[model samples]
Target: MLFAIRFTDHQSEYNVRKHYLNYHLDWLKQKRGVVLAAGSLREKHNDQPVGALWVVKAEHEEEALSIFSDDPFWVHGLRASVEVLSWSLAFEDMLKD
Candidate 1:
């Protein structure tokens, strides 16, 4: 199943995210699931990253949660809130195959 993981940064702990960035990206690359898309939610004016969004294809929600638990950022308390939702993509036109 596909899932969208929406993460919210802690208001006062945003600066803590830098500590685990490398570990987070590395885990993403080594994971088996497909990361269809990923990015941070930006502010309206300054375009600062206040949160994150990830689209993942995994066997189940439990598997997806496992992947998330391993992220260093999650461990360091940089992620204040997280929500995972089942998702579907309606188009394949943009796909290479």
Candidate 2:
């Protein structure tokens, strides 16, 4: 199953996300098979990241959660909350094979 995962950033400067950024990227690379896509969420006018999003392929919601729950950012408390929803690719043809 495909899952849309959103990791909302904690509204605090104490979240230490930048400190573990490299480790997080490394981990994401290792999980690329399951993590089809990922990136930070930002406002329209500014470049500040408000959260992060990922598209994951997993057997179930728990499986999807586990994939990101192990991320360095999550382990270190960069996320305030997370939402997992089953998703379908509406523009599949637009993507390269």
Candidate 3:
């Protein structure tokens, strides 16, 4: 199944996010196959990273949640809120195939 995980950063946690960025990226590399697409969400105007979005493939919701739970950012409390939802692509694409 496909899951979309949206994470909102904690207020004033940019420093923490930057500090653990390498570790978080390394962790994402370890789950390359499962992680379909991932990137940081940027704030308006200033272009600062305010959160993250990840589209992943997993057998179940719990498995997807586990992935987020283990992320260095999430583990270190960089996220203020998170939402994981099952997703279906409305339009077909080579990547989704």
Candidate 4:
């Protein structure tokens, strides 16, 4: 199944994010197979990232969410919360199997 995961950043953790960005990117690279799509969420006025979103392929909700436990952002307290939901793709042809 595919899962849509949203990660909200800790408002006060800008320094933490900056400090651990490299580790975060590395983690993302390692999960490329599982994470079908991923990117940052930015504020409307400024381009600063406020959160992140990912469309992931996993067998279960827990499996999709569990991948984040090793993320630098999550481990370093940069993430405030996480939300996960099953995703049903509208344009199935847009993604390859």
**Per-model CA lDDT versus the true structure:** 0.78, 0.84, 0.88, 0.90
When sorted by TM-score, best at the front, the candidate numbers are 4, 3, 2, 1
Q: Which stretches of candidate 3 lie over 4 Å from their true place?
A: none
Q: Which should have the higher lDDT, number 1 or number 3?
A: 3
**Residue-level lDDT tens digits of model 1 in 8-32:** 9887886676767787788777764
Per-residue lDDT over 24-73 for candidate 2, one digit per residue giving the tens place of the 0 to 100 score:
89999999889988998987647667888998889999899888778888
lDDT of model 4 at residue 40? 89
> Alpha-carbon error at 77 in model 3, in Å?
1.0
Q: Can you list the residue pairs that collide in candidate 3?
A: none
lDDT score of model 3?
Answer: 0.88
User: Least lDDT summed over 10 consecutive residues: which range in candidate 2?
Assistant: 88-97
Runs of candidate 2 exceeding 4 Å displacement = 91-97
TM-score against truth, every candidate: 0.81, 0.87, 0.88, 0.93
Candidate 1, number of clashes: 0
lDDT of 1: 0.78
Which scores higher on TM-score, 3 or 4?
A: 4
Pairs with backbone N, CA or C atoms under 3 Å apart (clashes), candidate 1: none
Q: Considering only N, C-alpha and C atoms within 3 Å, which residue pairs clash in candidate 2?
A: none
Structure candidate 4, residue pairs in collision:
none
Ordered by lDDT, highest first, the candidates read 4, 3, 2, 1
Best by lDDT: 4
Model 4 scores worst on lDDT over the 10 consecutive residues at 40-49
Over the stretch 1-97, how does candidate 3's per-residue lDDT look in tens digits? 8999999998688888889999999999988999989998987856888898999999999999888778899889899998999998886573553
